[model samples]
Target: RLEPGGLTFTLADGAFGLGGARTPLDAPLRGRITVEGKDLEGLVAVAMGPEPRLGGGLKATFSLAGTAGRPVLTGEVALANVTVTETNPQCPEPRRRTLALPSVTLAAGWEDGRFTGRPLMASVAGGTVTATVIAQVDRRITVQLGDLAIRALPLERVLVDFLCHAQAVSGPLDLTGTAAFTAGDIPRTLSGAGQVKIGAGRIVGVQALRMLDAIASVAGAVGTLLGPGTPVSSSALAEFDSITGTYQARDGVLTSRDLVFNGRAVKATIAGQYNLASGALSFDVVAAVAGRNVRARVTGTAAAPSVSVVPASLLSPGDAGRIEKGLQDLLKRMR
Candidate 1:
């Protein structure tokens, strides 16, 4: 109802707001909005297009002030039983699956064309996701994520269900990173640096593991003398005790120099670049076993990578010497 004091209106779902401005667009505005258990899907669609389908109940209490042209809003929003589904062709199968986020709470504000959500927290698959989001809407929308931390997040939920990637790794994942990307093209313009750790897992379809498996096949002659318990195998999967890495991404290219994969029988280090836009891989994997290194060059796309052991002719003098010494030691043990 419009009165001399201001305007007070009640929405369909018992949502209510009161504004204290003489004119609807005048300055010195004072308003408070309370919405309870409203459908989040409609709100999300209105704010962020209709691509990612969201389902949830949203509860919020916001204080609104400032002029119409540059309105300021501060609020606390809570979402319950949220499920989000979107298209991701990169996944192995069922390219679209719903991700259930049990709870999400945000301490947020908006001023002018910018939205800031500090300490946005979500509960996903028995883990916690925390991040600070800063989004600015101007000529093009830009989002900056700060203090992002994902603790013990399940790989199946993110990589398989959400991201839709063919590669499989099962474990609790811990990651801390900060990233900035454009709203429409995150894969093309994303830039970030982070450290990631996956605890006690089995990895398959990873290029490094593929290289290690190939190296074992090439050394099958030695494996025959070592007996059936030898680590040599053509199987493309590995049980890793832990995989830890620090990574940096710039303009859709990810580069790492010290990614270490620790397995019970073999350990490997990866150093190189992977192009996110084209899924091209250009990396070197060095698997260490019995104090010797089996080096391989990794190339091709992420979907189908090729690994070839680096010939002794391509190795440095020190690497060649180490390989030769390792062979001599193995022969002595056989005698």
Candidate 2:
């Protein structure tokens, strides 16, 4: 029926291209197989599964079979980044679906029987998403994330060069988490810790000031006026709160923070259990920004371990002035 797990024909002569050419999204397939790589070890194994369902018209499955020493094991599947728009003129700007991708030529690698380099070279909503991974091949597998790049690269790949320190500000945003399966369990238990490398890929100076609001007092303070002479409302100098929140997850854990918008720094954590058999998302996340101590309790499952933030402080107003000027000057060196 098939060659010794390498690549061969299955049934019809139309060349079904089973193993290597298939992806994880295409599950339980039975077709022809043929792969052309460097060596046999590099391409550990090949398989197919059901097409996974994401947010939009994202329908695709993935096939995995490789190790870190080998890199990639599966083949590339065709992807479509298409947007739908209604052509009617009078219908309130018509219905539009957006699909943004920055670069072309997308592919993935394999590390220890797991998939690597997924959702690469794509941009959406001004923020980027990508992953870096290192997986172990076994009956009970354990996978570790080298990095998770939100604004630049993928999350799994970023773990290699970054660390999970909640209070430090270096990289723009960092995501650190893990996945593991114990012995003799019906399913697997996946969970890990999270934190961020603050100020990594911020755009402007006001962004930095807002981040510090959670730990320190901002220099510029403005208020809104009324009765024909109200200050144009452009002045965002009012004191705000910090970002301190928590969450509990189901399939995994999810912790989120809205620090950049609130004019302050923040700290959030998401951790808990996720039952795949049941559709449940629970978590615990924390956020603290602008001298405001806060903890937001959430019950949603966002499976990845996250980055945490540490509190920051300055001595006095004079110290703040020096720090501010010095920080502005240091911007040249920080980024």
Candidate 3:
């Protein structure tokens, strides 16, 4: 029993029964319904949920076409705000995470309880995020981010919101990654790989840089005493001109092998693994110097990482002589 132009149903603050459960509608659900027809249009002014795990404040206007059984949907959805606050036992303070996307435009097709979309765009954090999203109803979800351009986003804000830690670095971050996981398995089952490029950042709260300065001073002094053929100069390690790294995550552990930082004072190569589930960190950093390589081992949690300089002999079996020769060759140039 349907009208000629289809039947229109409107609900104001209503509840719909789905799979033996009543799902409450936030604002109004207005749709043009048709029997044995190929098109249906709907508008949900606001849709909100109660569960903390499930985000709230959703608004969308969508149109479904194709057929009653299989349909294609094109829509624009926006979330006013969604905040998740959790306290990690390992962290000293409560971690608060927020995602406030003003709009997410999607042109997706739905078939067999799944929605597939390509090149979706969202407005977030004063920047544009473009990604391909695929979600299986009650099964799994995958998102592939491409060419994310975030302008002047503070690293401290990100660390405090996501990692539940104090700010350790400051800079603008650009990255791309893909994430996939089961519907119900969140942070634990999340896995992905990405590359991040940090532009002109300063590292905070690292005492090893001071030690490096002292070592550089001593090297310069020795070079001065050895007459004019020595080419030793002090290094600036606090601020970096550029930093880049590639990271891979599997089963809640992220590992990076090509983390490099270039600065006026020092150039460092970092390799390490960070446990996403436990916030634990274990990294080895090596600074290239004239006489020998300075090695520092960083371990503990991201909130409070511990750093210690180890002996240069621990680097490799026969690297000392090679480093000496390299230094000698460099000093020969100064002569």
Top TM-score: which candidate number? 1
Which regions of candidate 1 deviate over 4 angstroms? 1-26, 42-50, 87-95, 205-215, 219-231, 234-237, 289-291, 313-335
lDDT of 2 at 181: 38
Residue 177 deviation, candidate 2, in Å? 5.3
Question: Taking the tens digit of each residue's C-alpha lDDT, what string does model 1 give over 1-335?
Answer: 33321223333322122356566465454577766654557656766778798878767777877776567889898889998888776655676778899999999899989999998999998899999999998999999999999999988667655775655677789999999999888878889999999998776545545654656675563344333445555453367788899999998888999999887667889899988888898989877643357677889888788877766523445655666777899899999
- Mind giving the per-residue lDDT tens digits that candidate 3 earns over 1-335? 23431334332333223343233322223333221221211111122222223233444455544443344455554444433433454344543345445555655555667776666766555555667777777534544344333445556455544444442565677777776665545556667888888888776533434444555664464345333444544335567888899988887788999999886666889999988667788988887654456677878876556667675423455555766777899999999
Clashes of each: 3, 92, 2
Report the Cα lDDT for residue 63, model 3: 56
Write the residue-wise lDDT of candidate 2 on 1-335 in tens digits. 23323322223222223355455433333322233222222123233211111112221233433322333334342223422222232223322222334322235555446655444444533446554554565775455544444453322222211222122222334333333333233243444444433332321223223333422222212111101222211123222232222222223333344223232233334344435433243433343322333333333222222323322321323545665676687797888
Better of 2 and 3 by lDDT: 3
Give me the displacement of residue 251 in model 3, in angstroms: 2.0
lDDT of 1 at 192: 94
